[model samples]
Target chain A: MDARSPKRGRRRHGRFDVLWFLGVPILLIVAVEIVPMLGVVWISLTDYNPLEPDSWLSFVGGENYSRMLGDDLFWQSLLNTSYFALLYLPIAIFGAMVAAILLNQQLRGRLVFRGIFFMPVVVSWVVGSTMIMWFLDPSSGLPSMISESLGFGRLPQLLQDESTAMPTVAFVAIWKYFGYNTVIYLAGLQAIDSALDEAAKVDGASALRRFWHITLPGLRPVTAVVVMLNMIQAMRIFDPMMIMTNGGPNNSTTSTVLYVYRMAWDNLQFGYGSAITAVLSVIIFAIAGLQFWFFNRRSVER
Target chain B: MSVEAKHVQTPSRGAAGEGRLGKVVTYGLLSVGALVILGPFLWMVRSVVTPNEVLYSDSGGGIIPRQFTLDHIKDAFTAGVQPFDVYFVNSLIVTVIAVVSNVIFCGLAGFALARIEFVGRRAVTVVIVLMLAIPIESRIIPLYILASRSGLSNSYFGIALPLLVTSMGIFLMRQYVMTIPRELDEAAKVDGCSSWRLYWKIIFPICRPVIAAIAIFTFITAWNDYMWPLVIIQSQDMQTLPVAVGNMAVVKDQLRWGTLLAFSLLSVTPVLVFYLFLQRQFMAGITSGAVKG
Candidate 1:
């Protein structure tokens, strides 16, 4: 199979490789992603709702976008998303930074600590959410029992209560996420020159002074990235809110993504859902653009 | 001059003394922070083993379950809590297929992009980069429709196929492949190795670390995904771990907190075990290899 086989074998192999490697991926991407996205855009321009079969027969331009602006639920979702972002961004960034700094030091058993912290991040959110739900259960949960025992007298069930739902979701989201950010921060911290710390020490700086003046400033780019990424992620919150609250006793935990899902799937308002998604995409684009802008500005100044 | 040198050395010695105090504070803060991060996991283990009666007991100084029993574990295994077995199996199947498919395809695509200079290559690279910003939600509904139309809606292929070829996978693999020296390709070519043979025999082995990283990331992402499966699959028998666990936890009418907790504990063990073992690689994978452009 050596001499005469070379010509046939080479052609066959080349053909097979091209088909198997290049052709299949291109086909899969086109079939699954590109095609669907085009369909979504097409439907977004039409006044289509799965719930109303007749609406599919007609096309309307920008009407759905206009309706979305006046929709109260859309406004509520936007507000809810902003609030979620506000709560999640700072806690995740600062908590991760502090944890990363602590872990980055030559401490004992840092790997074990890192694993324990990051365990939740890799675990399915369903598991984490369910576990946290039990932890917060009013009647049978540990938190309520502790509260009652401590004479706080029956703490409200978090997921069921309007005021507590969104914040509680945020808390859990932070818990599940900070480990990833911490790891990123740890990576960033390692890149910093230790000579800066030594220089600060030689200048008679205190621990806090060194941290604020040198370490924090050194961590600015990472901080910017962490904050921006966290903000975007937090705004896209849905799974926990849906599982824990079902959009709540009163739409308290109705994040924008959740709202979009309900609109597109449950309410069957495809056009409206698409409009909301478009707005969200634009906003996210703007935020990320601003982050890049700030990053460039800082780099230039430095 | 000798007196001045002595004074300079004294301040350096004093700063060294301060460093020890700073070290103590740093370690103390870490210990407390570590406790906060790990506390919930400990509590979860306790809850899983604790009997319902103990869980619901009114008199409680600490919430740790007394007389730890295997009752919760027993019930979760026996009872049909949101079809636990089915969902677990479904998750395993999807994750395995997704990982294998993603790794091979991504590696091939990555190889082509990194080494080959062919027509349409630049366009392909640009498209992959731009699409990274687009989340699954943007294409989800349309994909759902396509899946339904194709009669693949509830099938594992339906859910796993789209995930198999992510832009992130391509991005990661491209970064990894670029780091391999071009000299190896030239050496292989001189040995009468074709381009595909060069990558397969020479390059793939050297890229094991990055490939392992990609595999772990893909596995975890597929295993943990909930929303898509929740939407597409209708059959309870086809439900994945996250979907099933979520359904159990959210059963509003008869919310069995104990059963829910038990199921949740069981479902996450596999993922946690995998993560605990490969965490360093996982961290490296996430942080490294940002696409330039």
Candidate 2:
């Protein structure tokens, strides 16, 4: 392996070899990702508006950040996003765990079952969110029909009701993503050493005990990854909120990203929108950092 | 490798003494799960074929529609600000360019990071990993500004530029490339093959599976992307399917249940068809990419 290292190879080296291979992607990333990332910080400090080109050159200091602190809608949207994550995270993780265990079983049509579960993941969010709206539509949806058939009284308009809109949106988000988490979990479950489970069985351990002791421990790393990724995704939820509820009835389902979108596009408040985005970016980075620290500490301890 | 070997052995262990009752329970549970998972999609399809009269009627909600019609689908194509066909073509153009650029650019970068002894390889890898943790949505404001300022907005290139080389794609390709034995490259070098020749003639050809995986993932993602395209492309004729469908939802009048459902069905059909044909590879690609990350 050392002999095969390009640095030590017999072939003559060129000064620009790295540039040849890395130039295009590096340039693209810098232009698209890196530049914009740095620009967001600057943009957040200014009162820039696309609609009024004159405001683009002016800086308003920390006014945007101060305004965001006092803005009820910004705080409400942040809370709404947190609420969605809090509700969706446990259900998605636990449901995916259960589904992954079932898929991992020696059952007929397991592959078909996996495919069925993952079907929603392939469907675009626009479609999934739209279908969910139709499914929950009080006037002519399945929920109302089912309620009527079961004599369970009239169903509320889930998306249009402030009390129910956030939860309904969260449920749709969970439905769209749990299959993906399940696939990751299934991969994690498959990677666990079967011999450990078999050994526990031979020691007269019950199925529940084996799963609790062996399988659960084996899946900790995957669970951390799944939890962190899902949380980040949930915190940034936009499409479902945009499509199904539009941050209404009365901003109940407004996510942080959706709020940023509205501020910038709908209100033409680019600086204020960038300020919220900066806050969100910080929060997300902190969450990710905390997750990595926790996971790395746990792995080291084991 | 050990895990895979045990996976093959464990199935036999489960089958040897498992009860008929257990099998029944497994099948029953899986059937219910499948029904729940597929129910919404079936309802979407049902709505697409159901006439507006039946769809709006009180007694009309079922997996099977009372009366069928393609009129809603026909209207969905024709009843937008711009025809749905234009949006579909715009989506195709953006997605095609994105997929091709991702494969070429990410493939080149992945190969270099995996095989080349670059001066700043470690730094580049760390930066990519860090970038993965940052959600692209958080950076949208500035990206939108940059695109607008550069006059890339409302064009296919603007829609495709930000997505041309994903950090995940680079990481996925790098991981796959690393698994290709170094001896092969060394042997190529011994045969007097230039570095470019080695990549083009030997390495790239062997990376077909990973390339396919990247292609499918990139294509689906680029096709289904909404927010970026919504911000970038303003003109009705230039809007992608997701953006156009999103606009339809917002407009209220064009968003009748039948028409909206038909629109949803049409928008997702291509990716759904792609997944149906290559699900194994798609699933493998996702799980492998996730595990490596």
Candidate 3:
């Protein structure tokens, strides 16, 4: 009995050793990810500037939040980001669905098509943004030259024009990201059983009816996942806007992230940036919670 | 055998004319979509080979030269240019360290999160989910302050450390690892193997597919990351690929379209090759983690 108890103790000690491997990294992740996030929240309550002396700063609760409420750029950014999400989400998701359905059909040279679409996803956003920038350049861009050729008149540099800047960014985002979503949808489509289509056919269903009744319903889970994923991605868009537009012409295309970055880095208003982050986080969490709620509802309904 | 054969074979007439029209339309739309998708890349390549005079002259016309030259490609690195070789190297070193560390640390953390029944697991999962949602840009300022305080602002460790604890990585590994049966752990335990030894000797090997998936994802993400490097690494010698291109654009006044395009294409080659080599696993990775999120 004594010998057996000692063995059990040794086994317990060995099990405890596994904790060592995890303890440090878990702590580090908490420190870096959670701690700074908390700092963002705290700093939102205080006026802390990285450039100014620490002693010169003062705590002003809710002032930054109220100021943000009235800040013109903040509202503009909110509008732009919303416009971006509104335009890109439905169009890109619909486009990807269409693309995925088409590709799911029996076709030759399909691999080449798959590879072509997937290329943009793999390409860095920086490269894509720069290429798009060149393609849209006012004087020497390909679009301008094409317009001239087609006798459509010289195209205004879209990125430079405030009227077109936000849309232009959205267009690029769609182009770069649709292929990724399409591939996911393709995987989802493949998972669907063919038996349902056969049953619908045997019931003398029309092609359109078959699609509406069978295919679309089958793709619900994937569609939900795609919509939520794209929402978050589209909401946090910054690099492309920063590189291509710089919130430019007249802050036409600035996003929340870019605004926050400019606030923190350019204006040295760390506290205000933190406040923007807080607001943005709340909005994101709300959207994500809505997605989860909808998802659970669907599952329950089935 | 005959029953199976009959089950496998189903004779059917192809769809009628209206269906044919639908197929044509679908294919046509897909073709146009492909053109839209591949257009920029083709133009990016064409502009590299075509002289600036021709590229700027014609837009939609076929610009692929019957005879091609490496002049622009050469000029990207040679034209009394700082050349991107150094940028490539710096990016490579940083990406390697970051990817390697993320793979190891995230794997262990993921295993713990997935397989280990311990206190605070639910909280850890919640934290990871929330972290994944919070944009990294939000925390950039504070992260910068922390790095500076730790004297890690410009070093490899500084750039690599913050990224090492990716919430996506933990989530990915947990999802993949969860699919494996706990009975495997029990079986190993019955074999008189310690838990640490079981993980090192058994579980790690079985987790290769997930590891590969994570490794590729982490590497690509780190490779393309521009914002953090842009803020932290101030010097030219320490610049990554995207930073180099950004700095080049700033310096050249954005007029050097040909050279800029060439540099852009050059920078994406390693990533393009990496994708081609691991196409299957990469699709799996993208769908499993990034797409779901």
Q: Give the Cα error of residue B195 in candidate 3, in Å.
A: 2.1
TM-score of chain B of 1: 0.87
How much lDDT does each candidate structure score? 0.74, 0.82, 0.77
Alpha-carbon runs more than 4 Å astray in model 3: A1-15, A52-57, B1-18, B53-62, B65-68, B79-81, B250-254, B290-293
Runs off by more than 4 Å, candidate 2: A1-13, A52-56, B1-25, B61-63
Stretches of candidate 1 above 4 Å error? Answer: A1-20, A49-57, A203-205, A296-302, B1-28, B60-62, B81-83, B253-255, B287-293
**All DockQ scores:** 0.36, 0.54, 0.46
lDDT of 2 by residue, B186-207 (tens): 7776677777888889889999
lDDT of 2 by residue, A66-129 (tens): 9987999999999999999998999899989887887787666788898888888877888888
**RMSD for each of the candidates:** 5.5, 2.9, 3.4
Q: Which has the greatest DockQ?
A: 2
For candidate 1, the TM-score of chain A alone versus the native chain A is 0.86
Q: Which pairs of residues collide in model 3?
A: none
- C-alpha TM-scores of all predictions: 0.89, 0.94, 0.91
Cα-lDDT of candidate 1: 0.74
Ranking by lDDT: 2, 3, 1
